[model samples]
Each structure stands twice: as structure tokens, then as C-alpha cells.
Target: MTQTVGKRPAEDMTQVKLNVKWGKETYNDVEVDVSQPPLVFKSQLFALTGVPPDRQKVMIKGALLKDDEWGKSAPKEGMTIMLMGSAEAVPVEAPKNIPKFVEDLPEAEQEHLETKRFGAGLHNLGNTCYMNSTLQCMFAVQPLREALYKKASGAGGDPTGRLVTAIAELFKDLESGGAPFPPYAFLVALRAKFPQFAQQTQGVFAQQDAEECWTNVMYAMREKVKDEDGNPVVDKLFGMRTRLRLKSDESAEEFTEDGMTYTLKVNIEEKTAHVSEGVALGLKEERERSSVAMGRTVVFRGGTSLTALPPFLTLQMMRFFFRRDNGQKAKILKKIPFSLEFDAFEFCSDELKKELEAPRVAYKEAQDREIEAKKLAKKGPGPSAVATASAASGTLTAANAVADVDMKEAAVASTSAPTTSSSTKLSMTGKYELVGVVTHKGRTADSGHYVAWVKQSSDGTWVCFDDDKITVRTEEEVLQLSGGGDWHMAYLLLYRAIMVDMSGAVPAAVSEAAQPAAAMETEGGSSA
Candidate 1:
């Protein structure tokens, strides 16, 4: 039989006789279609030799038959076609028998760690990295953690509440160190709440804005959870207090300040290229027609200032912009330096500057004591042996001790808070340190890997949480995340204010609990 695809293979040969050998079996007087493609012989050989066409490797004398070749492929009467491959499919035996379940495993093989803290990786369901990365980043936030774990039934299986519940369930799975948990439930709930997310990009995968997803989930979570007194937990933790100042131009009788700051918009196109500079530049005066200050349509220049800073400050680097040609949110590959510590005093109004003074002095003293303690420890115990150790300011926002000098340089009032004999007043806070950073690895928000650089509260260690693969990172690595290429670029920066609590307020043993038990015991024994 000839299986000719359009044309025959060769002119001189047709229906030739042959002897075929596949394994131990030998088929005599086999007919070969030499005029057709050489592969067609495999089919005839399969009928007599019992070897399948795919399994049969036909060879005449020393030369093997190539597929679709006729004259080139050795074929003749009385030819003993030797087959090298097997007639039957070989059984694939696995090297080791794997146990299906943990319980089925041998006692020695079973892992029983007392506490297995899993650095959980999120399985990217299509292109849902934006949600995964954003969620992972915000998961470190104390308030969000509390709300998620203790989520109450609001809207009762409704889209918003379900989303919250799904997130809580996800956290539970992530806490365990076994498998990569897919965000299926949460995604389903997300699509329900916001149908726009269901809209796919890349022919079956949905690409979403990580920041937008973060905001939406936050909004829904905030809506779902509230305090007994009806105070929203999200608002208490993440809400910032902003006050704006404005000035009116000539021909305006009612010279009022411009409208208040409602939005957090930071542009990165700066002269010096710093996040602080971009934020400062964002506060520069802009023209706007005011109702009170401009009945005559006079020039209005307004500036925004933060009166009360939040416990956690979120600073978004304006790195992505719309590219008209590609119709995509293209990333700006500009290097913007990021600092661990942040100070908003320069961005605040002159009137508010007075409030930060007293805390500034106390924080500086605390820092000085810390430096003194370190120095004393190196020099063997002296008068500085009793130097107070600075503990993280608990609950209250504590300004960075280093930024305290900024206040003195600005010529702010040098007033100190009245300290009691028993304890110190540690209420001043404005300086912030990097808590977490949400970064992007690709050129656009719609198509890229999103990751989080989270700082450990127990120790000031920065960890890069890329999906589920968490790795300990250095301070230098975190600083280098400021954009410039195809690598991970810092997109969202979360800063936590340095908090300070005095030793007198907390018991020495309780205060030093984080220290090694032996060290704490030795210090106590020495003191006694």
C-alpha cells in the first residue's frame, strides 16, 4: 500500500519483497512499498511483524530507513530488515514508591516539628500576581492581620464578607509549610465584588493592578470589620490626617488658603531624584480658581501638610505612567533613592512644627542613651552600665532619634515634656522607618511579577517575600530596590514610625524579655 502525500517517493521500486525482524520474531516474505515514502513500509511491517509503526525502527543490512525517503532508504528483495525497537511498550517502573499521605509514611520518615513556620508561597493562578503580591505585603500589617484572623460575619456570604473570609482562610493555609495554596476562593470572591477583574487579558489570564487590588480589598475589609463602638479598624491603622494651606492672588478680598489635601499623589520626575523630593515637589503650589478667595477668578496656590501622622505611612512611588503608543502603564526606569527613615517635618506647616519639639528632645536623649550603652558595653561596665536601652515605642508613634536634630536646626522651640519620677512621657512621633515595600519586576503593572520586602518586627531584618519564596535580605539589598531596570523596583513603600517606651514604665525583666534567657537571668542576678 502506498501512502503518497501529493507525489510518489521514487520511480524504479514498488511492492518489493523483504524479511523483517522485530525482537525475536521473524516475518518472511514481507512486501515493502519502495515507490511510496519509506515510513509506509513500517505500516506493512506492523501487520506481519506485530510491531507498531512508531515502535518499529526498520533497517536494511547496515543502513536504517529514514521517514519519507525511498531511493535513499535501503530496500530490496531478499532483504532482512532488522528492527532495533521493541514490539511491545516497555513498562516504566518508578524508582521509589512514594507514599500518598503523611500518615502512610514510615515513622522515621515522618516529619514532626513542634512549630513549622512556613514561608508560604502563593501559587500564581494565571497572571494574578498583582493580587498575590499586594496581599502578601499587607499581610504583615498588624491591624490587617488582626482583622483577617478575627473577621466577623458581615454581609453573610455576600461578595465583600466572603472576600474577607477567603483572605482569612488563605492566611490559615499560608501559615502551614506544606503546599503552595492557590488564591482560588479569594479570586472568585474578588470577581464577584468587582466584575471588572474577571475581564481577562492575555487570552485566558487576568492581569490586574496590584495597588488597585490592594485598595479594593482594603476597602471591602474595612467595610466588613469595625470596632464595638463602630470605629473602622482599617481607618484607625491606615488613615492619615492631612491639613492643607492655601494662598490667593491679587483682586481677591477674601484671601483664604487653598482647598485641603484629599489625595496622595507623588510624581517622580524630580531634579535630585528622591522620594522625599518627589513628595515635596507634589506639595508645591498649583493654580486653581477658588470660590471664597477668587470670586474674580484670581490665582490660587495651595499646599498640603500632615497635621497628625498615621501609625503606618504608605508612600507610593510614581513610577508608572500611561504610554499612548502601547496603551499600557509603562514603568519609568529612573533610580530613586529610598531611605529606611522618613521625616515629614519639612512637609508640615510652621504651626505644627511646635508640636513635634518636646518629643524630639526626648527621642534624641533616648538615642544618645542607646549609643552610650553600646559604647559602655565595649569598654566593660562603667557609669554607663546603667544606660537605658531603647525599646520600640509600643502603640505610640516615636520619631526617629536622628531626625530630632532637624528640629533643632529648624529653630523649633526646645520645650521638654514634664517627666514623672516613676516614668517618662514618650508621646511624640513622626519619623518613620521602612516597614514593607511592594515592588514590580516587569515593565508594566498589567504584566509583571509583584513582590514584597517586609521588615521583621522581632528584629529589624528585611525579607523579600516574592510570591511564596521568602528570603532574608540585607539593608543594602532593600535600598537598591529603587527602580532603574528590568529587575524588581520599589513601587509602594510602607513606613512604620519609630516608637519608644521608657524602661521605668515597663518592668526590667518584662522589658528585656526579648533578650536571651541566660543574658536576662545574668543581668538580674548581677543587679540583685
Candidate 2:
């Protein structure tokens, strides 16, 4: 025996005043919607008291209220109602028709399904792919994203803090799981901060360089976002220390300097088929300069060696150069290859290599064990525990003994050497894993489309973020971004340190890992 709450439809509902008594407190003139169910009325009472709607037992004139029924008489003004029961915890209801399990879908369908599941894609506002691509790459840095959200959330009111707040809100919206959305607010903030981004061509928005956008945005974040101790967040994640060396060929005198840099600039050449080659070339250079000791212009060899590696590393390829003939920045179309795993041990100074030795050995040992176990599993019968250990040991020894003779020789020929401070050190071995890339797909810097390819941490899968279009890509496909022709080539690369724990290694030895090599201090200009 249940009765409808009211004869009239919900739209016809009218508000009435009633007196509600709960415990020793009496709420006078409580508003109640007459046409709604009793549950709705109970919700109103729950608000006054701490009782939840389900736990509330309400009655009027000794008649127990039914959730669905209005009873014989409609609620009238100035009626007295008794509210009873204690607050009860309500169970959260699971959402219905969740997206299909991505793993169960076919490989072809998985990409589409994953794209839909993440519900993220940035809309391109005219030629703003550069901004969108760089933002996507920035979003891939999980720690940075979390820190920004915590610091900038709800602080969007101040004009000075609009850029950081907009970034935080945009990241929140992207993570909230919908359709592709435009980052109009973030763009407006960026343009306001850097008028260069607001440049237009004949009243139309102009295409900009993704690397330039990335650098300016990074500068803005560095200025705006600080940690509890008031250190710039970007510095901790992207800063690096270098040891600069200069030797006058005539005087045979050497001068050493220390410098800091945010991004490693790779000098690409026609022979630079790989990123390592460009890096090696970029590290050493010979230029003529005025020597105080020589009392004249003399040839000086100068180069940088890594003293410390940052948690996150950014490498910018020097593909665009100002063409003196046309007075325009033009791109080099040579193909250059990069790797998924970058071992920067060769680039480290001799001292840093010593500090990295223990962890490098440990990483090699772990890799060896995994490989041996996989091999044993594929052999049908299980190998004895002793045999497995012996095999892993042999493999580890071999791996540890491997030395890139050519790279070392090249370094010896040129002369070279190496962010964040944490209780537990990361990237102790000078190894980095590629996590994100910003690529360009046109011949010139001014007329190319930019796209981002970010590696999904949960599944270790690469997702191509081309404006509002998202699709999964294989590692091979991502690797093909190396420039060959008028195709997309990696313009900016982001790498994250590979964290591995070495049981016997002393963490303190590398505790000053991200700090400048202060022990070998000297005056030097900041590196680019």
C-alpha cells in the first residue's frame, strides 16, 4: 500500500513552509516541494540534520512518510513534521555500461577503443598544433602534472597567475574523461604572457614553432610554479649541470668552467644518421677567440661534459637554421635516428662514470636475469636454479664488459665529460627512456604541422596525438619519425630517467647528482 507523493506533475510542484523537529532542535519554516516524492523531502531534512536521506524516518500527524506516496492530503503551509533516525553512510553506485575492456578488443579496435576510453584530444585552433603538441608532451610528465594541479588549482582569478592556473585546469579537464576540447583559455593566457605567440599573418593566425612554444611555456612555468621550499619545479625536472673546458692551442693553457642548461642542443650534420652522433658533435667545437695569455686571437677548443643528469631530459635538434640567402629559418631534411632507451654513460665525465658504475652493473645484472629466465621458459623444461644463476651471471658479465669503443675513441678525440633532489635517487646509471616527442611534418619551420607522440605509462603504448585525432602507434612507427623526406621528424624529444635500485650502492655518493659540480667550480656562461 503505497500512494503517489502528489497528483500534480513535478513541474507543477509548489514550495510550502513546514516546521521540522529533529532531536532537541526545531527548524521553523523549512521549505518543502509538495509534488516531489517523500525521499526528496527526507533529503531536505537530511541537510538540516546530519542524517542521510535513506536513514531519515519522517512523519506528519503520526503518519509515516512513504517515499513514493503523498498520502490523502497534500503538504500544507505551517505543518509540523517529525524527523527521526541517525545519519547512515550511503554506498556509492557503480556506473553502468562502462567502456569495453580494452585488452579484450582486437589490436586494430584497441587503438580506437583506447582513444575513446581516455576521452582526451586537444583541438587545433587554426595553426596552433604547435601549442597543442607541446602541451600534450608536457602533460605526459606525470609528476609535473600533479604538482601543477596541486599548486595552481582554484588560483585562476589573479591575472598574473592565469597561465599556470589555466594549465592546471586544462590538465584537470583532459583527465576528467569526454570529447576533444579546445585549449582556448590556455592559448589566450600564453598569448597574453608572450606577445610573440599572438603574431598573425594578414589578419590570420600564423603557424609557430613547437620548440619555441615549448621553451616559452617552460619559462612561464618556471617563473610561476615553485615548490614548498620555493624552488622552481621546472628546474628540478629539466635542469642539468655541465663542465666546460677551454684550451688555447697556442698557449697550451686550459681553462675550466661550470655551467647549467635546460635543454641539450643537438648539432645535426649531413653525416649525423643517429642522435648520438649529433650529440657527440655538439659537445665539442673549435672556435677562434681573443686569448689573454696569447695576447691575440687564437684557436681554442671548447666542449661540455655532463656533471649531472636531470630527472627529465629535453633534446632539441638543430634542424632549423637562419638561411642568410633568404633571411628565413629553414629546416634540414637529413634523417636522424633516436632510440627508445638512451644510455648517456658515454657523455658523463670520468668522475660521474665512476659514481654511475655500481648502478649500471646492477641494471645490467637485472636485465641479464630477465633475459635468461625468458630463454629458460622457452626451452620447455625448466633449468635448475644453480644453472639459471650461472647463466645469468655469465650474461651479466658479458653485458657489463661491453664498451662502445668507437664512441669512446670519438670522445677521446674531442675531449668531453655531465635535477631533482630526492631521498631515493633516480636515474643513477645515466639512462633515460623516451616518453614523449614533438614532431614536424613540413619542409620549413614556418609551414609545418606539429604532432605529439606520448608513451602511455599504464600500458607502455605510444599514442599519436595529432590535434584532435588520437590513435595508438607501434614503437617502430614512432621510430620512423626520424627525418628522411618531407615527413614528420622528431623536433623535440623528452626522456625520463630510468629508476633502478642497486642494493650495495651508496645513495649519498650521487646525492649531489642533480646539483652542479661545485667541487670543480669555475666561472662560465649559462649553456643553452
The model with the greatest TM-score is 2
Q: Candidate 2: TM-score?
A: 0.67
Model 1, 360-473: lDDT tens digits are 555576666556656666777455453432242331223222122211111111222222212322233456677788888887767778888887665666777666466778
Off by over 4 Å in 2: 1-113, 117-119, 154-160, 287-289, 380-427, 504-528
In angstroms, the error of model 1 at 431 is 0.9
Tens digits of per-residue lDDT for model 2 on 63-175?
77886777864578788788888765658896899787768667745544547655478877668999999998988776577668767864444443777887887888777
What ranges in model 1 sit over 4 Å off?
A: 1-118, 252-264, 285-287, 290-296, 382-426, 502-528
Local accuracy by lDDT, each model: 0.59, 0.68
